[model samples]
Target: MERWVGKVAIVTGASSGIGESIAEKLVKAGVLVVGLARRVENIEANAKKLATCKGKLYAMKCDMTKEEDIINVFQWTTKNVSLVHILVNNAGGNPGTTLIDGDASRWRQCFETNIIGLLTATREAIKIMRDNNIEGQIVNISSVLAHSNWYFPTINAFDDGFV
Candidate 1:
């Protein structure tokens, strides 16, 4: 079933893991898939494989933590594709540091990358989607740790807002 035929989708962190799986699913559904990630080589290599799939695949190098990079990805998509129909915000990871042993710098890094970066990307995506009159879906990949009551020091340090 080509449920996503003619649709455009951007999947961040598409270089590996769940992000990769999501991109593959979208591609199989006939969506034009742009895989964005910091690992340029990995995404590019994957894009080559996706080229033979049911949809078009474009791989772009993007550092989610940087505003310029995010903007560039959106601009590129707008320029080359008709519209963005979906955005998968899938570029976050646990730092594996407990609150008691983790330095303030590490804690800040997690918040910056997971929370701030996601917000920035979402804002830009919304702007583009709204301006183009494209009704799009934004899927944020959150961790189970965000809700679990287990007292992992690192997880506890994260703000509730991130959950």
Candidate 2:
């Protein structure tokens, strides 16, 4: 972590939960963190709380389900911040609907966010790393549900792919 001081990282779904925790820790290690999420205000609020930390946090509005939003965030980061040295793909969720009775539209939303979005972000981050010749890190956060026998039809179905 000390080696990452003054480096740059992008963390998706950083508005709350595990994403928020990751961002906080990275910032404390003196890494500049860009928190990307639809709840930009939440990230901004947390940024304020961490202003005195060794690093800094910037909030960006991003809807992972939208490819354009994902692309734009990376572009914005390169132009506004330094090239990214780390990427934490921590954004994912189910619609809380069971497979048998779930709406197709909701299911599509879940797949778009939990699967396609992650792929897109990882591809973009890799491009940046390759172009800059930086041996950066990419962390994909997956739930224990992926490996469990406990069935959460909506969640396990998607999360399982990560493992």
Candidate 3:
């Protein structure tokens, strides 16, 4: 991780939960982090708390379901923090709809966020890495419900999407 010190990282869904923890850890390791999520205020608050850390944290409002939002985030990072050395695709959620009885719109929303959004972010990140000749890392985060169905059954429950 010391090698990543002073590097730039983008973490999605960083307003809370696992994403928040990952962002904090990276910042502590001296990695500049751009935290993205719809709840930008939460990230801003967290950034304030982490101000004394070795690295800096920037909060951005991004809705993973929107391609433009994802693209804008990357652009912001490039112009503001430098080319990203790492990207964490940590934003995802289920629409609370079962397979048999589900709303198409809700399911589509889930797919866009969990699948399309991740791919778009990955593609953008890779392009930056390749263009800059940087060996960057992309981390996709998912829930355990992806592997086991014992938990609640949801139409958009994370599974194999990260793959």
Estimate, for each residue in 17-44, the C-alpha lDDT of model 2 and write its tens digit. Answer: 9999999999999999999999999999
Ranking by TM-score: 2, 3, 1
Residues 1-43, model 3: lDDT tens digits: 9989999999999999999999999999999999999999999
**Deviation in angstroms for 37 in model 1?**
1.2
Model 1 lDDT tens row, 1-163: 3546878898888899888889888887788988888887887787788778788778899987788888888889989975688889888866667667776776676676777778888887898888878778899987766656565555555543245
lDDT (Cα, 0-100) at 97 in candidate 2? 73
Provide TM-scores for the models. Answer: 0.88, 0.94, 0.94
Q: Can you list the residue pairs that collide in candidate 3?
A: none
Which scores better on TM-score, 1 or 2? 2
Runs off by more than 4 Å, candidate 1: 1-3, 159-162
TM for candidate 3 is 0.94
**Residue ranges of candidate 2 with Cα displaced over 4 Å:** 153-156, 159-163
**Residue-level lDDT for 119 in candidate 1:** 89
| Better lDDT candidate (1, 2) | 2
Which runs of model 3 end up more than 4 angstroms from their true locations? Answer: 149-151, 155-163
> Which residue pairs in candidate 1 have backbone atoms (N, alpha carbon, C) closer than 3 angstroms, thus clashing?
99-153
Tally clashing residue pairs in candidate 1.
1
Residue 61 C-alpha lDDT in model 2: 98
